[model samples]
Target: MEQLFFILLALLTLSAALMVVTTRNLLHAAFWLILVFFGIAGFFILLHAEFLAVVQVLIYIGAISTLIIFAIMLTRRIMDPQQPRFNSQWGLVGGLAALLFVVLAAVTTRVAWPTTSATLPAEPIKQLGADFVGVYAVPFEVASVLLVVAMIGAIIIARERG
Candidate 1:
């Protein structure tokens, strides 16, 4: 049952990710990206990392995805269907990406990775909270400020459009 669920979730994630890249409409692509983020949060839940899953949904789905949708809404030209999706150098970039994927696949298959199950710390959530407030407070606050600035900018642009 768990294996089946994992396979299904993996397929859903892969399909959503493909849609995110292939879809021409920026809004549709953003929605697909949200689905991909949800799939990742699902995987984190499956791995017994509830904190990480919640963080994924709150940060990626709630914050980041909302920001992306706002940006898409603000940028009118980005949704123009007449604009070419692929550039002249697409083929060269695609070839390089394919080659890199092949190399990474070969390297991953050749590795003898350990299959041992590791135990989690007794109070990981507490430690994480402490670290966030004590050590990582500056960066975390900076991120919050950045998000606020982006939202204000989006609103300003939208007001102009209106």
Candidate 2:
């Protein structure tokens, strides 16, 4: 069952990523990116990282995706057809990317991961909260501050001149 889920999640992630890269419309690409993020969050859940899954959904899907879509909608000339469809160097980039992917896959297959006897624990959310508040408190606070600043910047950018 877990293997089946992993396969499905992998397919979902890959398909969404392909959609994001191949879609001509910027708005459709953003939506596909959201699906990619959602599939990644599902993978995190499968790995017993509930906190990561929730944070991925909350931060990427909730905040970032909303901001991207809102920005797209706020554009005055959204349907302009003058935008170039593809970069001239796309073929070269795609070839290099394929080569790099092959090399990485070979290296990944060669790696032997460390084995652990510890069983998966319950109440992952509680454990994650404790760790975040205790050990990761500083970084968490910094991220919150950064997000606030970004929000303020976005508001300033969108403000109308009076």
Candidate 3:
């Protein structure tokens, strides 16, 4: 069951990611990106990283994707139909992306992952909450501040010019 979930999540993630890159419409690409982010969160859940999965959904899918969609709507003029539909360098970009994927797969397969004798804790939610509010509190606050700043910057950039 877990293996099946993993396979499905992988396929969904890859398909959505491809759609994000290949789609000509900016709005459609942003929607596909949301799917990709959600699929990644599902993958994290399958890996037993519930905290990461929640953060991925909250931060990427909830916040970032919303922001991206808003930006696309606010900057619709840039995506005017008169503009050329396809980038000329797509072939080169695709070749480089494929090469990078092959290299990463080869390296990952060659590396020996670390072994652990301790069993995974049952209450991951409690542990994650403690860690976030204790040791990681400062970074978490900083990230929130960064997100606020980014939102403000986006608003400023998207404001109509006189």
Candidate 4:
């Protein structure tokens, strides 16, 4: 059952990712990307990383996807169906992307991944919460501040355009 679920989730993620790249409409692509993010969160849940799954949903699917959609919405020209979807350098970029994919695939296939039989922590969420507040507090706070600043900048830019 778990394996079947994993396969279905993988398929969904892959299809959504393909749609994100192939869709000409910016809004449609953003929606597909959100689906891809959801699929990642589902994978995290399958791995028993509940906190990671929640964070994935909240950060990627919620915040980042919303930001992307808003940007797409604010840019009226980008949503124009008559606009040229591909640029002159698209072929070059596509070739480079294919080469990168090939290189990554070769490297990943050659690497012998280690299998760990160790059990997970009994109270991983508690430990993670403690670490966030105790050790990683500063970095975590900094990231939050950075995100806030980015959001503010985006809003200001959008307002200026309007």
Q: Candidate 4, overall lDDT?
A: 0.92
- Candidate 3, clashing residue pairs? none
**lDDT by residue for model 2 over 49-130, one digit each (tens)?**
8889999999999998998888877783753557765799999999999999999999988899788999987786787789
Quality of model 2 by C-alpha lDDT = 0.88
Error of 3 at 23 (Å): 0.3
Q: Please give the CA lDDT of all the candidate structures.
A: 0.91, 0.88, 0.88, 0.92
Candidate 4, residue 75: lDDT: 77
Q: What tens-digit string does per-residue lDDT give for candidate 3 at 1-162?
A: 888888888998999898998787889999999899889888887788988989998989888889889888977896776776668987898899999999999999999989799999989889878988999999999989998998899779867798
Between candidates 1 and 2, the one scoring higher on lDDT is 1
For 54-117, candidate 4 gives per-residue lDDT tens digits of 9999989888899889888877688888887889898899999999999999999999999899
Most accurate candidate by TM-score:
4
Q: What are the per-residue Cα lDDT tens digits for candidate 1 across 1-162?
A: 999999999999999998998788889999999999999999999998899999999999998999899889977787998887778898898899889999999999999988878787788899888988889999989989998998899778767553
In model 1, the clashing pairs are none
- TM-score per prediction, in order, is 0.76, 0.83, 0.82, 0.85
